[model samples]
Target: MTRSQTTLAADAELTGVAFFTGGDVRVRFRPAPAGTGVLFVRTDLPGEPSVPATIEYALELHRRTGVRRGEAEVQLTEHVLAALAGLRIDNCRVEIDGPELPGLDGSALGFAEALRSTGVRELDAPRKTLRVHRWVRAADGDAEIVARPAEGHGPAAAGLRLEYHLDCGPERPVPPQNFRCEITPERFLEEIAPARTFITADEIPALRAAGYGERVDAADLLVFEPDGTVRGNAPRFPNEPARHKLLDMIGDLALLGCDLHAAVASRKGGHALNRDLCRTLRAAATRGDAPITEAIGVSTDPAAA
Candidate 1:
């Protein structure tokens, strides 16, 4: 739902020992003036150039998602992105000295807890929203994501319906997985954010060879084992994979450059659909386009449910 701009309370400044999963790293976030959006500055980079979390700067989405500006980029950014979007904490500087955000417990709890402990303050400034005026949609293959403003702010939600047609590996025991939930920050911390990320049994050899999650052991990520082969870490829920997909979708969609104001449902989607939809809408917006005025997946009979 669309919270009034005043509901944000105020701009905030957050500071604490930065942890990169392995342990505490050095970093901090100070509130920028309203409209600054979220910016990441890598102190570890030469002269510490900054990266703005905008669709124009999105680099790629593969085994995981990363945002970049030319050769300089950040990897596996979904966790932090999830935390920011879920918490509704807008406008802060993410200063770090690494290529990846600390994957604390494969969840957003660390970031949430740290920010909570630091406490939030009210800044004497106003917030801005990139309100949708018309509809724009995009798709890749069979997966799709769409956005349309409701008559009014009803509920703030980021949802997904992901279907894995095949298991990730020979040892994989899990069948097709899926789930639907409202996108609320409170729901995130208590019900969703704590869920650990998982990889399939079949992906292990390749992920390791690719130099991703190299420091992690099997336990750190869910590796499914069927029979003698191992599966992902034990799932907190029966359909943990799809839930994590929802988490990643919410995280990725946060880059849309605005706090959402409608119910968004995604079907069998991933970072590919997530980023594609944003780029499409953003381009339309650059040309003064608006949200889709025409109907799409919705039906003409509104009362039928």
Candidate 2:
């Protein structure tokens, strides 16, 4: 059966420290009307400037995703976007009191839990989905992504599926890791949401030198040593780094402003490459270049069920 659009049932709030700024931030998720799309409002700004959470507004990939509108910008938006998309939330008003989102536990779990507690309310409108009818690929050096037609099964019939692979190299510590799964709200929370973002022990100095991560401690995130041992925190999943990559990918894709129906295979790809793919897909859809398939593995007729 086709799914209806969704938003939060009630307003929810979260507060923590910004990873880069070390400043306190308060974020609120308010339920938006049908078709409103995800939005970020800077409540701290003079005019309370708002920006749509779309790839078109995505700026430079300086370690994270930043969405901008004129002079207003929001940094590190991927985690919150991932939670909204993972839960199949279609519309939301994300109000933040700072330039960047709080880096709560270095994972999307905090946002997910808050949103879950508020509950999801289905809208009257049927969800809009973008189907991939042709193979499309984008790359940046060795990192790459290939999107193909989905094999409509379970969640893939309504949304998308992802197969992600991450290789951190031999010298850096963490070994090669990969994961493949059909994307869904249930699967995301259990398999991907809990996976925290990670950094190598060696990268600490450079990160500090660059003026970032001042508020986050080694224990607050997954930190691996050159000897392949975790520094302070434990991993939520065996291949937690790879799963976090998948989480980031989902957040980046949410900028498409609709549910996606494709099988995306990614290898060592980061924010820049994912942004490029999103732009390419939007262009192809605009030009009517890629063919459209209504459903893949399941019957499209709601009555068929």
lDDT of each: 0.58, 0.85
| lDDT per residue as tens, model 1, 67-170 | 78654576666777777777766666777777666665666666666655544544454443344445545566666666655444323222222222223334
Worst lDDT run of 10 residues, candidate 2, spans 296-305
Deviating ranges (above 4 Å) for candidate 2: 152-156, 292-305
lDDT of 1 at 16: 26
- The collision pairs in model 2 are 152-297
Candidate RMSDs in order: 7.6, 5.1
Please provide, for model 2 over 94-212, each residue's C-alpha lDDT reduced to its tens digit, 9 standing for 90 to 100.
Answer: 99999999989988999999999999998998776678878889998888998888776665355588978999776779889998878778998899999888999888999999888
Name the best candidate (by TM-score): 2
Report the error of model 1 at residue 16, Å.
Answer: 14
C-alpha TM-score for every candidate = 0.77, 0.93
Cα RMSD for predicted model 2:
5.1
Worst 10 residues of 1 by lDDT: 296-305
